[model samples]
Target: MNAYDLVRGLHILAVIAWMAGMLFLPRLYAYDAEQNAKPEPLKSEMQALLRTWQTRLLRIILNPAMILALIFGVWLFWLRSGQGADWSFAHQPWMITKLIGVVLLFGWHGFLAGQRKKIAAGTSKYSGRFWRMTNEIPFVLAIIMVLSVTTEWTLR
Candidate 1:
């Protein structure tokens, strides 16, 4: 239909891809951690495989999806602001709240990238349980962001 609709659709798809990658990556980390406690050729082989999986997912899908999602998300935010003529909508507390969640989500992504590096290098500092816990971050942020965008809490 419209350009906004198209951009929004693409943004949603990118988010799906990005979230899927985020969900799966930490499992890879957990698996890597498990493999690390093993011995010899199996350990090395599993580590190499997990490293390859993590790197490819990060560089090939996750990073690009994140960039696209950000671009489209920003575009949608700007679109909602209605050019430069209107500023009232942008001042909504819900908008600010949503943005904070987004910022935190991005920070989580950065943290994952660092973790990826450590896991790949076999120098990860945390346990598999740590990664398992961190995997819930996106879900929490998603809930907050969805509520912020969908409900008129500020308008009430």
Candidate 2:
């Protein structure tokens, strides 16, 4: 009904899009790796297609969505704190948990980057182990976030 509600709705959607795309991207990288590891080499057309699609996906879609989601999250939190609760960094369990998940999520990105690097260098091979490991990163964070949400303010 109000502007805040509209912004919050869009913000949630943006966060979902960003997180889902980010989670799926590693798998996409694995797919690209398959193509990249062909016997000869990727043809110029194939390379061009990869470059174009990857660039558009990240630059035009993922990055903007992530930035907007982050901004909107900050705004929503500020609104929440403004209403009553005090949100601080020093000693909130949920905050700390979320922060940890964020760090792990960043580390997950490092793994993704490593896979991409190895793929680019023509040294990467995808195995079940690799995919499982890469996929677990986000799942772990999702679990943490879910738990944090459910018990964040209660068990103190």
Per-candidate TM-score against the hidden true structure: 0.94, 0.69
* Candidate 1: worst-modelled 10 consecutive residues by lDDT: 80-89
Compute the lDDT for candidate 2.
0.64
- Please provide, for model 1 over 20-79, each residue's C-alpha lDDT reduced to its tens digit, 9 standing for 90 to 100: 888888888888888867988999998898899999999998899899999999888777
User: Looking at candidate 1, what is the lDDT of residue 105?
Assistant: 79
Name the candidate that leads on TM-score: 1
Best by lDDT: 1
Candidate 2 on 70-156: residue-level lDDT in tens? Answer: 788677666657544676532577867866776676566556556555655657668534664576567668788758855775434
Model 2 misplacement above 4 A: 1-7, 41-48, 83-85, 88-90, 106-132, 153-155
**CA lDDT, candidate 1, residue 126:** 86
